[model samples]
Target: MLAIRTKNLGKEFWRQKKASGLLGSVRSLYQQDKERVVAVRSLDLEIAAGESVAFIGPNGAGKSTTIKMLTGILHPSYGEAQVLGLTPWQERQRLAFHIGTVFGQKSQLWYHLPPADSFFLLGRIYELDQRTFEQRQAELVERFELKEFFHVPVRKLSLGQRMRAELAAALLHAPQVLFLDEPTIGLDVVARQSMRNLIKEINSLGITVFLTSHDTGDIENLCRRVIMIDNGNLVIDQSINSLKRDHLAAKIIRVRLEHPVEGLPPIDGAQVLKHKGAGLKISLDTKKLSVDELYMRLRQLAPIADITIGDPPLEDIIANIYRHNQGGGEGHELEQEVAQI
Candidate 1:
């Protein structure tokens, strides 16, 4: 069963176009010029029940707009959408019972209250029975490891602790779907990993997850499928592995030499990105030069104490997708692939 589906879904906003300078500003009050900005365009998407999907794009890429439409926070300007078998815009109140949303920059919890108090307040909001609410709260607190700080005021809790509490509060009603927007935005490494693990565990319990995040680690570790959009248009919808395989063709080779190196030998497809005493970093185009060939050449240059080769970061892969679409190079191919997928 599909948890969420959309057909040709789109959104637009009308804003007053401001004029520059004092004279223009004075005239603008009476002469209001307006322009339409397309936040999302012709989006077709389907997410299966119990699937974890990542919806990602650069800033101003309509990622948040799409989520708002899906969650029924905003109505689409065109087309149709059904979330969990109901029209989101028309059945928003009914649909709210089955879904939960967590926005990193926004808080649903009461600022001055403890998480325990907020959980009970949410229970009332969801109209959960006293016994059921208590059971659910206990279960979530245990699962989210919130015992130590559950009684602490939200304002006094650490960011990580507060996030865990926020998630627990969202799940108080036993939602079937969870929409997470940058849930780990400000967390440190340890906290981020903890949150990821908790989210993974939650998804394992059969809730559908639709997530949006700028952190590559969140997408790489949590989601199996990726839906990428840019400039208000869908760029690609593919499995995470497929995205890495197709776009990540470059490799970085970092070498620590036994002695300081003067210069690197010229290689056709490899460029020295950085060189310092006893250390060298080279960027290699794997499509042009094989790793074995590069290694052989490096051996000939100097005695190598240690060497490590890794693919370019996920950020680079996503950037390359945007660049390809902006240049009008491989976007057509990607659209075709998305259709097949």
Candidate 2:
């Protein structure tokens, strides 16, 4: 079943026109000139139940606007959308029971109260029974390791601890879908990894996960599929593997040799990026030379002590995609609006 779907969904905003000179400013005030800005334009998307998808884009690319529309926080200017079979704007109250949202920059928990208090309030809002709420609360508190600080005031807990409590509270009512916006932003390395693991666990339990993050690690580790937008237009929609393979069309090979290498052998698509006495870093274009063929040639160089071949960093791949789209004018139709997502 489709957990989320949209067809030609779009949003627009109007800004009052400003005049530079005194007379023009006075005329503008009297006339009230305004210009229409399209934040999202003709977006069509679908996400399946139990799927983990990353919705990514550059700043002001309408990622936040699209998510807001989906969550019923904002109504679209045109077109239609459904979240878990309910029109989000039409059935927002009902949909609230089945969906949870987490924004890294925003706090859903009360600053002065302990997380336990917030959890109970959420349970009441979701209409969960007393027994059920307590059982779920215990499970979340245990799973999130909140015993040490569960009763601590939210303002006093560390960012990592507070985020953990936040996730636990969001899951207290067992939502069917979760919308996560930069859930690991500002977290330490360990805290980020912990958050990613917890999100993966949530997805494994069959809740649809729609994630938006600037951190490439989140996209690489958490999402199977990626849907990217730019300037409010759909730019790319494909699986993560396909996105890397098709867009970048290259790989990085690190080889540690048994002996020092004076120079690399002639290979059509292979470029030696770095070479030390016994280590080599090579970038290979898969379109011109196959990985197996490159491996065979590398083996011919010397008896290899060790080798590791992997894709280029996801940041590079995403940058490449963005450059291609921008140079090709793929998403220039929608006026770039200043937005925070």
Any runs in candidate 2 off by more than 4 Å, and if so which?
Answer: 16-33, 261-268, 292-305, 336-341
RMSD of 2: 3.7
Judge candidate 1 at residue 268 and give its lDDT. Answer: 92
Stretches > 4 Å off in candidate 1: 257-259, 323-341
lDDT of 2 at 159: 93
Highest-TM-score candidate:
1
- What RMSD does each model have against the real structure? 5.2, 3.7
Residue-wise C-alpha lDDT for candidate 1, range 191-272, written one tens digit per residue: 9999999999989999999999999999989999999998788888999989988886778999998889787668999989
TM-score of each: 0.92, 0.88
Model 2 Cα lDDT, one tens digit per residue, 132-202? 99999999999899999989899999999989988888898899999999999999999999999999999
lDDT top scorer: 2
The TM-score obtained by model 1 is: 0.92
Give the TM-score comparing model 2 with the true structure, all chains together: 0.88
